[model samples]
Target: MLKEALAFKRPLIFADSFFVNKPERVEMILFLMSLCLLVYNLDQRELRNSLKRAKTGVKSQICKLTDYHTLRFI
Candidate 1:
């Protein structure tokens, strides 16, 4: 995901640099739309990974706590 973002960054920066001088309304709007889409997708991907990690961590901790309680009772 980081690699993909890095790959995308170069072209986006180049396009912005190219258009920054002329400052056309339509081009700027399009650029903004594309940037928003890229950011949204990247955010979603990162959120999913974070949630997955949290879930796995919670499961492991729960298992450990359960084992500890069982041992104490025994």
Candidate 2:
């Protein structure tokens, strides 16, 4: 993902260097901003999934511990 983002950005940076006009620069800036936002959203989604998996693992462990304790009492 990082590599892809860098690939997308490199051409735009090169283009910006050649184009000095206001409108084109504005368009390029907007494109870069949107690209950054997209990358950020993808990162956030990955983080959320990881946290969810961790939560599920912890819950299962707790359930197993509780079941073991209950069985011991019986």
- The predictions' CA RMSDs to the true structure, in order, are 14.1, 15.1
Query: What C-alpha lDDT do the candidate models reach, one value each?
Result: 0.50, 0.52
Candidate 2 lDDT tens digits, 1-74: 45644454553355445545598778888797788668765765565566566664222333552211111122
lDDT for 36 (candidate 2) = 69
Q: Once superposed on the true structure, which residue ranges of model 1 sit more than 4 Å away at CA?
A: 1-23, 56-74
Best model number under lDDT: 2
* Candidate 1 residue-wise lDDT, 10-59, digit = tens: 54355455434455876877788679767766666565566566654222
lDDT of 2: 0.52
Q: Spell out the clash pairs found in candidate 2.
A: none
TM-score of each: 0.42, 0.46
Q: In candidate 1, what residue range of length 10 has the lowest lDDT sum?
A: 65-74
